[model samples]
Every structure is written in C-alpha cells, then in structure tokens.
Target chain A: MKMAEKRPLDDTELDGLFAAARSTGPEPSGDLLARIMGDADAKTAAVTRVSRPEAGRDVVRARPGLLATLLGLIGGWPAAAGLMTATVAGLAIGLATPDTLDDLTGGVLTSVTGYELEDFMPSYGDLLEEG
Target chain B: MALDALTDVSDEALLIAFGNGDAGAARALTLRLTPRVLGFASRMLGGDRAEAEDVAQEAMLRLWKVAGEWRQGEAKVTTWLYRVVSNLCTDRLRKARGVGIDQIPEPEDDAASAETGLQDKARAAALQGALDELPERQRQAVILRHIEGMANPDIAVVMDIGVEAVESLTARGKRALAAKLAGRRVELGYEDG
Candidate 1:
C-alpha cells in the first residue's frame, strides 16, 4: 500500500525538473556580455572616426584663423548689419535722387517701343502725345 | 518608471532602449532572453549544445546590428529572435546533410553511463537523449512548455505559430515523451507500482 501511493505531478515538480535541466546549459557572464557589447561599440567607431586635439580640447580655440574669423563675422552680426545698411542706403539714395516721374516711366516706354532708354526719355511721351 | 511598467513596453521599446545605448536594458534583454533562444536552438539542433550556442549568440549579434532599425511599439522582440534562430538552425541543418538527433542513430551508448559518479547527471543525460529523439517541432514545443515552463501563448509567440498549433505540438510532444519514457519509467519516477 505504501509503494502504491499516488503522487500527482505538480507545478513545483515541473519547475524542479526544468530547473535541473536548465543547469546543463552554459551560463553567460558579465565579461562575456562586455565582449559582445564592445564588439557593437566598435561598429560605431567605424562610421565616424575623428581625433580632435587632446591638448586644448577643453580650452577655447587659441586664435581663430583670419579666414575663419572673417567667415564667422560674415556669417554673424557684421554681415546682417552690412545687408541692412546697404538696403537702407539704397532706399535713401533712391528717395533723394532728382529723377522725375518721367524718368521712372522712360523704361516702360523703352520696353513698349524697343527703344533705348537714352534715346526715348522725356521727349518720347511728349512726341507721342502730339502725334 | 519601474520594470513592471515596462511590461506594457513592447519588444520594440526594449530594442529602442538598446539603440539609444542603454546598456542596462541591453543587459536585461540579453540575460532574460538568451536562455530562451538557446533553448530553441538546442532543441532544433538535436542537443548539439555547441551549435545551439553559436546560433543563439549569432542571433543576438544580429539583433544588435539591427538595433538601429528596431521600431518601438512595432513587434515583439522574442518573436523576431525566434524567427532568426529558427532560420539559422534550419540553414545549419540543411548544410550539414543530417538532421542529427531526430534520426536516432542505433541507440548509441549507455545513456545513463556514469563516467562521473553522479546519478543526477546520468538521469539528465538519459532525459536529454530521449529529447534528442523527438521530432523537431515536438522537441521544441515540449522543451518550451514542460522543460522551459513557458506559457502556451508565449510559446506560440516565440514559435511564430498559432495557439492551436502550440497546443497540438505540446500534446503530441508530451505523448511522444511518455512513449519514449515508458521503458525508463522507473528513472523518471513514473513507474506503475
């Protein structure tokens, strides 16, 4: 009767069996992981490999080159100021010029007649009106 | 946020962490993962532990390579790992011209041989030999369910098969295992008194 005792398979038994089996496989350690990850990191190095100056890496650039400084200035406030000044100066000159309404209309007449601007200025519209 | 919150996080989310150089997440994914992958490979390769290790390791290396493209919230990481390992195993088996373990080569040696004086080792070896004789899917299914203690749905996910398929494999595998173990029932503690 003792030999015939029934023992049902339980979750714990199954886990025990499996855990025992799991012990058969190799265990990957931290160093193994580091090797794999390091190999991956090497791939990143292949893409962009540059070496900056180690001596002054933390310091501000000692002396910006003349061309580099010029380019920087051109790309910075000086260029913006130059552009605004040019625009404002051009507008002021246009406003102060003694050129009349006829002078402004001359180019339009020249395009319409295929005539040169010098040849068909103030006299041209007057001649046309009379004719 | 805690790791439990990350249970909701998709495989792709874990992969995205890996891509962003999150070494902790990478380590977690590896430790929590490689065993399952190794288990699958080992089953398919018919207990050729070395080849299985290679397959699992290469599969993981490929995962790292594709980390850049892994989209978070897209697919389960384990599924992708399974498919990769499966393909690798298939490729290796195909090239080797022998489906090593499934073809029971004349019942080789004393499966319970004790070159070492360990009864547990002998039993484990005998169990492994029996497992080696099982058909590919049966072995895989059984190893996943009975041996690895994986849930049916997760096994389905890892095997890239439906739940019904998983159920069928497990049932058939268990039946085959029972048949195979009938002779060694005393050893497996399943003897009829």
Candidate 2:
C-alpha cells in the first residue's frame, strides 16, 4: 500500500509531521557535553597562558629601570644638560677674573707712571748681583 | 558584575570575548550552541548519535578557531553554525556512499509515555526513512525549514541559495515525504486525528 499521498499534505498536516520529527530527535549525551566543555576549557586556558606574558611585559615597562630612575632623579636629560653648562661657565669665570683684573690695573698704571710693573720692580739680574 | 554583564551579551560579542581570552564567554557560548549543533547534526546524519556528536564537536572546534576572525554583521552566529553543520553533514553523507535508513539506528529517548513514545518513534522513524530517499539538497532544505522551524531567509543562508530556491526545494521535499508516508498514516495513528 502507498504510505503517503500523491500530493503533499497541507500546512496543518505538515505541522503535525514536523512536531513528531522534532520530538524524536536525539539529545546530546552527558559524555558529549563533558568532552566539548573540556575542549573549551583547554582552549581558554591556553589563551590565558599566552596572554599572561604580555601583561607581564606591560608591568615591566611600567616600573622604571636603574638608568631611567637615575635620569628621573636628575630631572631628565634637559635639566642634566643645563646643569653641566652652568658648572662649566662658573669655572671659566672664576679662573679668568684675576687675570682680567691684573691686565686692567697694569694698563692703567703704565699710562699714569709711564712704566709697567716690570719697570718699577728689580730685574732677576740685579737680584743676582746683590746676592 | 562581569559575569552578569556577559550573560546579556550577544553571541557575536561573546565570540569576540572568547577570542580575547574570556573563559566565561567561552563557557557561555558552549552552553548556548553545542546542543543545537548536536541536534541538527543528529537529524542530518539520519540519527547516528555517535557520528552526530563527532560532527557537533568538530563544528564547534571550527567556531572556536575562527572566533578571532569572525566579522560581526557579516553573518549571525547561528547562521554560520547551521551552514557549518550542513557542510559537515554533506561531507559525511558523501563519504558514506548512499547509506540510507537501513544504516540508521533507532534513536534513544527516555522521557515519554510507553505507548505514545513508541508511536512517536515509529512515526519519526518512518519520516526519516522517507527523508533518506530524497536528494541531499532537498533533504537539507526540508530538515532546516520544517523540522528545524527556521525562516526561509535563514534556511537560504544555510543552504547558500536564494529564498525562492529554498522554498522550491522544501516544497518538493515535503511532497516526496508525504508520498512516502501516505501509506503509513493509518498505521502511524494520523488516521484517527
């Protein structure tokens, strides 16, 4: 005997068939769930482990190293350069002051007395003869 | 707070989170998607429970691998999954070389009245036996549209066909199913109703 119609059934008949088919479908087993969840956890853990080092790198960069700490203490590179320049300028001024003042005085004395300091002072030869 | 917030997140967002190493999102997605995949695979593979489980696992594995590259708005997660299950089922069917309901084992169900449950099983089995007789595309269309209760457009996405084409395939499939099952109507208890 024929099992089905020569024509397809209408919507209502179709719904009944669909419902029967849906009800009879198999469910996922407990072992299947365990296996899938196990796989998901493994993958997630692998991703977590892979990301930890990157987070570690960010932490490492955040904390200053010895050279960075030293530079920071000196108020950075610009301040260090400025300090070096000021120290050198002070040393140069200090070393040149006496010579500059002596030159100025000798010139003035020579103009007023018509002689330099050397003219008023005994020569090395006169000192040797007296001795 | 974060878990609560994640509970309302869309599947697309959950996948992005999973890609970014959020274990909670991964768990949420597994819970949401795996059963659907198994059910669809079980139906498509003609109720071979073990093979269905394998296909579901493999499809989910692919989803996890591609989560990093899954473009939102390109396709819905459910859409992509149905397509994947369809392709996997097609591949298995091809490899099985025309194996039909003769190879289909009885489904195991535990939560129904004895008389009604046996009748439902018999009806479902008869329908499955008829479904195995249709062309693969028609079978896929019929299963997605009728048994799975998907919209025509979504079925189109899964089948990679136009909505019109999906309509045509499912129409033809249902006709074939009706013809095959027409003889069993009385025996299957649809005659009284």
Candidate 3:
C-alpha cells in the first residue's frame, strides 16, 4: 500500500523558520573582528600617509637675493649682458672721445662755440676760481 | 570622535570619516558591519564558519580600501557590502562545486536548554539545509529577502537583478524551500495549517 503524501510547509510555517534563522544568525568572533579592524587601521594609515604633506619637502624656497631680484627685473642674464655691453661702450666712447662720434655730431658744438669739447669742461684753475 | 559618539552617525558618514583618516570611524564601521557580513557569508557558504569569517574579513578589507572613494548617498554601505560578500561567496562556491548538501554543517547550538529554544535551533538548521539545495541566485535572493529582511529593491541591487526578477527568484526559491522542508515539518515542530 502507498504511504500518505506530506504537504509542503505553508508561508506561516516557512516564515517561522526564517524568523528562527534570523534570531540565530551567527555572531562574528573576536578574532574575526580584530582581523577586520587591523585591516581598517592599516588602510586608514595608508590613506593618511598619502594625504599628509611631507615635512621640509613642500616648503617655499628662500626668497631671491636683492641682486638676483634686480637681475630678474632686467630680464635675466641675456638682457643684463646687453645692458652691460651698452653701458661699457658708452663709457669707452666718452673716455676715448672717438673721432667717429665727433664726425657724427658734425663738430657742431666746436663750430658753434668756437671751442673744443674739452674746453667746455672746467679745469682745476677754473674750478678754484669758481670756488 | 569617540566610538560612542559615532553611534548615531550614519554608515555612509562613518565611511567618509574613515576615508578622511578617522580611526574612530574605522572602529565604528568595523563593529557595525562585520556581524552582518559574517552572517550573510555564513548562510551563503552553508554555515562554514571558518570560511564565512574569512569572507567577512576580506569583504571588510575591501570596504576599508574603498572607503576613500565611497560616494555618499549613492548606495547604502550595507548593500554594497552584501554585494561584495555575495561575489566572494560565489567564487568560493564555484571553486568548491560538488560538495553535497549533506556536507553543509549545522549551525552551532547556542546552549539553549529550553525546549522552544531547541526547536527554534532545529528549525533554523532545517531551513539552512533546505537553502543549501537551491540554485545560487535563488539562494541569495531568498536569504536577502526573508532571512536578512531586506526590501526587494535593495535585494535587487545586492543581487544585481531587477526588482521583478528578485520577486520571481524569491518566489521560486521559497517554493523550492517549502517543498524541500515539507518532509521535515513534523521533525522541526511545524503543525499543518
């Protein structure tokens, strides 16, 4: 003879099982918690290290010296060299009294005043007389 | 901030704080999430406590790594963690295929001497045994919906399926469970309705 068939559990009974499962859910062990927390600590430390500014590395450099500042203001070494060349050339031309420059001026001062360029400059005696 | 002080703070906020290097937030998040992760992993792995613990630890480690990039209000922290644990358990389950449902371990008895308590434990164990027989997706959907008490939409997010699909999976899963457990009803203290 065939045995009687069993019926499937109803929703209420199944829910009871689910509720039991929920109530009996496992609690994490202290060792598991420690391992997870250790990972968190290590990860946090790594992130902190990445975000932290390193000492002595990110500091603004010392301010430029006065002469260096002046040099920079004049447009760096190339411009400074150009200015120096122009100044020295002017000084040499004035000291040497280049005839070419006198010709360029067409000797106009000498002709107009009937005196050389040196004559316009005060001598020691002239200076003493003026004093 | 103190751990106690962080009790009222949201999980997303705690994660952001941890991202910003708050050790308190790390502790808070770890304490808050590990149990849930472990429970889900335990059920997914057929109550393999050791493997569940490993999965829980790895999942939390991934969470810590991602805390720095956790986008607040985009997803709930628990949902994201469930997804991670799901994937990890799936990988392990795939690797350990052919392990019969009989191999599934019974959950530890919590020293419940009372008859009701023992009945509850037996019911829970019986349910776990039936859950072990379902397809992986069905198992996940059922656990997330019934045991974990998650909403269908959130279950969809965790299972990476649409809400309607979650409903179908859970329906089929519960039917399968009911059929599987029908034979054990008398043994598990269930009365016919």
Best candidate (score: TM-score) = 3
lDDT of 3 by residue, B1-193 (tens): 7788889999999899888888889888888888889999999999999899999999999999998888879999999999999999999999889887667676676677888878888888889888988999999999999998899999999988899999999999999999998888778887643
Q: Kindly list the per-residue Cα lDDT of model 3 for residues A18-50, writing each as its tens digit.
A: 998887889888888898889988987777687
lDDT of 2 by residue, B42-97 (tens): 87887788889999998888888788677878988988999999999989988998
- Which sequence of candidate numbers ranks them by DockQ, best first? 3, 2, 1
For every model shown, what is its TM-score relative to the native structure?
0.57, 0.70, 0.74
For residue B92, give model 3's deviation from the true position in Å: 0.2
- Please list the residue runs of candidate 2 whose C-alpha ends up more than 4 Å from where it truly belongs after superposition: A1-8, A52-131, B1-8, B98-100
lDDT of each prediction vs. the true structure? 0.65, 0.80, 0.88
Worst 10 residues of 2 chain A by lDDT: A2-11
Clashing pairs in 3: none
Q: In model 1, which regions exceed 4 Å deviation?
A: A1-16, A29-35, A46-131, B1-14, B99-120, B189-192
State the lDDT of candidate 1 residue by residue for A13-96, as single tens digits. Answer: 334445546655445545545655565565444322432353356457467778668768779667877888999987876677
Please identify which of the two predictions, 2 or 3, would achieve the higher DockQ against the true structure.
3
TM-score of 3: 0.74
